[model samples]
Target: MYILLILAAITAINLGKAFGTEKSITGKSEYALAVDVRVSVPSSAFSCMKKYGYKTVFVRGYDPTGDGKFDSNAVDNIHNANKAGLGTEVFMTPQPRSDKKGSQQLVELYEGLKNGDIKVKTIWVQVTSPVNWFPDTKINIDFLNDILSAAAHYEVKIGLYTNGYDWSQITNNAAADKIMLW
Candidate 1:
């Protein structure tokens, strides 16, 4: 039981580091926990999450398939989260196989968020799931570059959501050192 407790503590520390919830010199977390959701949640849900110690929420901002449009609930979700006293951010899962270019995808999301009066500080781009990426590494790199270029035009920060293996398979770890990782 003591060993299990030790392992749990180690896991928690690693997760804290990954989420930027660094531990202070006094051994207490300097930041509160965060949560991510892809669906529209009630305002009461966000209040409960805050009550449980969550400080932030990341909402899905785009839908890549079918209509390839912004998520209908993203604005409402962000407002609800903010109303419940949680910091809100947005994330997009790019569709590399679609006919649309990366820049076009990002523009659609950015404009939608802007029209809804949702100010996004950082847009986390999910680059996992090899099946969602192009088979050619160069194509994947170009696609990611397009997204980066468009993000620059909008002046929003971009974060990558990927593991080493998935990243290697998708873009051969291109620009891994530059962009923030989630």
Candidate 2:
């Protein structure tokens, strides 16, 4: 029992140190941007961010192939952003999912971005439907927590964007560090 207690203490200390070292957005290297890709040309939209000299560029979720889901083209966008020398991020519009599903979606997104050599700096949830309230039933406090946790694991900032209190449900407070309201 004493050995187990010592191990637990060491683990706790390590975990605390790790969380303490998590990144914060309090420096000039960090920047804010706007990406309304849902209604704008991606290349042109990203270029606008560069022209404006924003270190970070937010992107609306892309289903470039019209497959009804994000695909390799999403990766291509990340590569394009990297080539432009700007950090990329995504504004996720959940289409109904659980925390596990949301995490998997991010994994897929990260895979595409990493494989395409695109460096993603953050991902912000975009819950913009006031009619349905929750556009995707999968989007919830648990889902937000899962996404933010995943973003931290990947070293990508997590954020959310909405006109009002769309994301008022999530309690992790990561969106404070990760979001840019529009």
lDDT of 2 by residue, 1-182 (tens): 01001001111122212345658623333224433344333565456657976454445453422222454345655556656777656756654333235566666677666676666787666655544334443445555566667777898876555544444433322235424443
Instruction: Give per-residue lDDT, candidate 2, residue 180.
Output: 42
In candidate 1, where is summed lDDT lowest over 10 consecutive residues? 1-10
Best-matching candidate per TM-score: 1
Could you tell me the lDDT of residue 36 within candidate 1?
Answer: 73
Residue-wise C-alpha lDDT for candidate 1, range 1-182, written one tens digit per residue: 01001001111244224445656434564555777787778899889878988777878888877636788878888999999999887989778888888999999899889999987778999888998777899999998889999999999888887789999999886765457767
Each prediction's RMSD over C-alphas, in Å, is 7.3, 13.9
How do the predictions measure up, each by TM-score? 0.82, 0.53
Q: List the residue pairs that clash in candidate 2.
A: 96-136, 97-138, 124-159, 159-178
Clashing pairs in 1: none
